[model samples]
Target: MAGGLLGTDVVTQIGIIVRDIEKTSQAFADFFGVEKPKWFLTDTIDKTQATYRGEPCYGRAKLAFFKLGNLDIELIEPDEHPSTWREFLDQHGEGVHHIAFVIQGMQEKITLLAGRDMPLVQKGEYTGGRYAYIDTVPQLKVAIELLEND
Candidate 1:
């Protein structure tokens, strides 16, 4: 997977953390002249506890998925919990949090990144794909990930 990292697609989505999901979605729609995105609220979705830097972290997030020519511009609003986007929200106040790149083999890529000591910040799968993140640049307050077809 490491050897083939450069063989996959480019970073397709630039995720932004927004305060008002609907307003933000509308703004992006107006700016891009497109339809409103598909919104998914995750505040009651994943209940599993995850480890972040050896500490327990719990949370949920709501997302708006905007499809744009084979790419999705995602707007995320994090629910109350110490999620990865918590700091990004407090510091930047609703802006880009991460860039998602689509790949072919997610677990294989996860193993490759883990071997490099870049453990997953969190991982999950949805209808379109499976995704896993790495906090390689934690200070940047953003995550880089591997998204592949499920």
Candidate 2:
């Protein structure tokens, strides 16, 4: 609720899990009357160094993004690997996965959230930034993603 935890209250992105990113991305484009965004695969383990529940995970996903105003709508199609995305899609089916906030200190935020019972589920690095998913469903009914850009 306060900047003390997340550094800011502004949500920059909303990620949705889907079985087929191409189809879903088109759906969004049609509904919004925007250009269909191309979907791409996330970085590999060598590049991302992704982890799941504190263990190295080789999971990767296809991602497509649509920017509207200041918010981005992300569509994710997870591979059959161990990851927060895959787990969410398996347990809850395709739907909203996480709401992301751009933050400063990712480790500190992750620690603070963990202290409040929101444990880190998965984490990985992107081209110019990093991301972490926190299991906040128990309290917020949705996972929270922390994005730190370099």
Candidate 3:
């Protein structure tokens, strides 16, 4: 269970696509009785990188994260950039986009999924780590994000 690839039955974060981060973050904070979460602009992300359908691509989004007990609730406001967030908002409207798992062997997990036909849809690097969103809808019913935190 510890080293297995995610979507083998584990979820670390619940990500929701929203239209407005300020409004939605405040709403969720108010409802959960917690302080407003800090929002991060994807524009500031370092080592930024992405791909769509196996081709190089780019996207921007505003994100906020709130802790709810042991799990995290993430809100994403897709900007004009072409990204998974934008795609989800465009196709499905605002809703749950994906469940994430912090993995140890990031590339290994990605390769395993890729072997099974789950192509990497988006990827980017931040301060201490990187993340990749896999198009795993066919089997998992939702995308799965693999994170490697330093």
Write model 1 residue lDDT over 96-150, tens digit each, in one string.
7778887876777777777876677776555666666676665445677667775
lDDT, candidate 1, equals 0.72
For residue 35, give model 3's deviation from the true position in Å.
1.2
Output the lDDT of residue 6, model 3.
65
TM-score of each: 0.76, 0.97, 0.88
Q: How many backbone clashes does candidate 3 have?
A: 0
Model 1 error, position 39 (Å): 1.8
Candidate with top TM-score is 2
Q: Give the TM-score comparing model 1 with the true structure, all chains together.
A: 0.76
Clashing pairs in 1: none
What is the C-alpha local distance difference test score of each model? Answer: 0.72, 0.93, 0.83
- Model 1 per-residue lDDT at 79: 79
Model 2 ranges off by over 4 Å: 1-4
lDDT tens per residue, model 2, 1-150: 577578798999999999999889999999999999989999899999999999998999999999999999999999998898899899999999999999998998899999999999999899999999999999999999999999
List candidate 1 stretches off by more than 4 Å: 1-7, 43-58, 138-142
